[model samples]
Target: MFDPDEIRGMLISAAQQRMALTYSEVLHALGHRFTRPLMRQLCKVLDAIDEDGRAAGEPGLAVLVVRQSDGLPGQGWFVARSGSHADLPLDWEGTEARRYVEARQGEAFDYWATR
Candidate 1:
């Protein structure tokens, strides 16, 4: 079983290594410490934080992140339109997106890093 402290430590370490961690990355960092449902909830909270840029406000988009067995966070970046207009295609290159995901995931755990 994963202790809360252990999970916290892992998150901190990941955050420092990657710079920031995405919502899904946070859950993935938790590893076996939390169940899938619990991770989902965490992801929701993380998204809320991301969207609001604060601790409150409705999410601008709904994204699903699948957990990988290798302990790395798998990202599926999906953006939804806030209005009736169609969603814009992501222009970020694959490598850049991957880097962004890793950095965000890193932020999820770094205690020293300010959100």
Candidate 2:
């Protein structure tokens, strides 16, 4: 079974490196290939990570895991956003979404760098 904490660590490393990993890259790190089922499972873990981050006043770590096509999180990620991120645009493939993701990713990258 995939472990959420382990994936979280991977995301932390990416954040510190100030780089985004494609969904396939994330799964590959775990010795798996991209599949809808596995991707969904990863998304669930990402949601949990963001939920925990929210409680801790940290930026969303899932922002570091994105689609290679547009360098943005999948639609599932936008759908899962809540709390302070509830105001995100409904359109995921546009400039608004890009800026929102960049800012969130920057926060994680900057915050992780300080640790």
- Work out the TM-score per prediction: 0.35, 0.94
* lDDT score for residue 37 of model 1: 69
Scored by lDDT, the top model is 2
User: Tens digit of lDDT per residue, candidate 1, span 1-115?
Assistant: 3344444444445454544344445555656354666665665454443455323432221222334442323332333222322433343335544554445444343433553
lDDT of 1: 0.42
lDDT of 2 by residue, 15-79 (tens): 99999999999999999999999999999989899889889988889989999898999998887
Query: Model 2 Cα displacement at 21 (Å)?
Result: 0.5
Clashes of 2: 0
**In each prediction, how many residue pairs overlap at the backbone (N, C-alpha, C within less than 3 A)?**
12, 0
Model 2 spans > 4 angstroms off: 82-86
